[model samples]
Target: MELQQMRYVVAVAETSNFTRAAEQCQVVQSALSHQIARLERELGAKLFERTSRRVRLTSAGEAFLPAARQALDAAERARAEVAAAAGEIRGRLAIGAIPTVVAVDLPAELKQFHLRHREVRISLRSGGSEELIERVQQGTLDVAFLGLPLGVRPKGVHGRELARGDLVAIVAPGHPLADREHVDLHQLSDEPFVDFPPRTAARAQTDEAFAAAGARREVAFEVTTVDFMARLIRQGLGVGMLPAAFVPDVPDLPVLRLRDAPARMEHLIWSRFPPSPAAAAFLSGLGISAA
Candidate 1:
């Protein structure tokens, strides 16, 4: 099968929409569909089930997608390697970061890296730490900033510690614990809380701390982003825990250190597999040795 057809399959798998996949691949929808149909015929298995409402991968497509993605990545890496040999650092670098990563000055770092390597393309995605880590392991993200539990390291991913800091409690000025310098997990047991949803590293850290303290908090609001959590806390919806950097600087919003909370360590993680040349260069620019 042609490499371009493999790319089309991967794109359709990712988008789950033929038109969007075609747009992403910079090809016409009919052509992309024709190519995919040819590929399915060649393999004697339908890759996708198409309907008016949605396009979803068939069972065979699910089985084939991972290898297809790996082949695409391998081809891109080969091109990047040749570019590196020619003294050119040119390729796409997909990076992931959690919402609470403001403390790392990521924008400034990326600006500098881009200035130094203008030919490199950078794509940034924001998600929960666990999601970012999963993407890294899946080879979708070249590198990611993850807020892992203290002393906890995920398997099959190489990570370097970027920063370690306490998770602080944020509340409105009139909240009972607002004036406190530090609040223990148990103290907020009965309080209404705003927090990250399950499967997020920040949520995991908070859950572990509360469980260790034998406290069960009432989650009044569950948000996907730190900024939204801050806004909710500021509106007195509920108190929430986040990295200090993620807490807004409003005068009426108070940030108190968590007395018994374990520090969350921000790690720059990547897959154990070899990195693309662009990824390697970006990591090196960040003073990380990806090798």
Candidate 2:
């Protein structure tokens, strides 16, 4: 009926001696014996037989002992699980990321996180900043790596400033702008451009920064994926403004800083606590440069 009763039954079954089981359980012998007797009485069967020399299980005791052991074991396992879920060392983490981080930082950060907490499972999703912010607000994601300001103030979601840098204009090495130390918004005013969809972080930074400088855009393409955008740029289809951190492994695609453009914003966000131990561990683990 009670976990204590099951525990008493299990102890008696394990030691086969009231005195020994009581000593092991840090309880007095007669008190342990009385509790076990009470348990057997409640069950309508004697669970043990005792003589002057020793104690042993009754036929019912033999049958019930294994069940008692299993019950205690199950109770212990459940307690451990609940405790772990509360603040224990390991569990699953669902994180949302802006598309740029998936290409730039997530891999290394994830590697360090897993190195410290091998038992935790991690899931990552990539999307535009607003979509990721919405997922965090709707409880669909535990955390997000954001590259732009949430277009509007978002509720139920909070962010930590991760890194702040400018958007770099990327072009193939042989392109006319690649050799320039700095590229101005005016240089690309008539040249074709690859852009993030409207209202997205990438779009806002590119549009606002250049427009503020009185530079106009010649829209050549609109695409969301960083890699694909780079591919398009490599082909000279259009040049794109990407997070300053994105450097293509290919030597031919040079990313140039937009000295003439406004700065790009970056952040990491999460649903309000209760944050997982994993989340705290991750945020703490990030470099001071990123934090």
Q: How accurate is candidate 2 locally (lDDT)?
A: 0.73
Score each candidate by Cα lDDT: 0.86, 0.73
lDDT, residue 11, model 1: 92
- Model 2 misplacement above 4 A: 1-81, 85-87, 102-104, 149-155, 248-250, 287-291
Best by TM-score: 1
lDDT of 1 by residue, 1-291 (tens): 999999999999999999999999999999999999999999999999988999998999999999998898788888889999999988889999987785468889899989988988899999988788789988899999888889888778998888888888878878887778977888888889998888778888888888888888888899998678778887888988877666654445788888796578888898898888888988888888877
Q: Model 1: which residue pairs collide?
A: none
**Superposition TM-score, candidate 1 onto the true structure:** 0.90
Q: Name the runs in model 1 displaced over 4 angstroms.
A: 248-252
Cα lDDT over the full model 1: 0.86
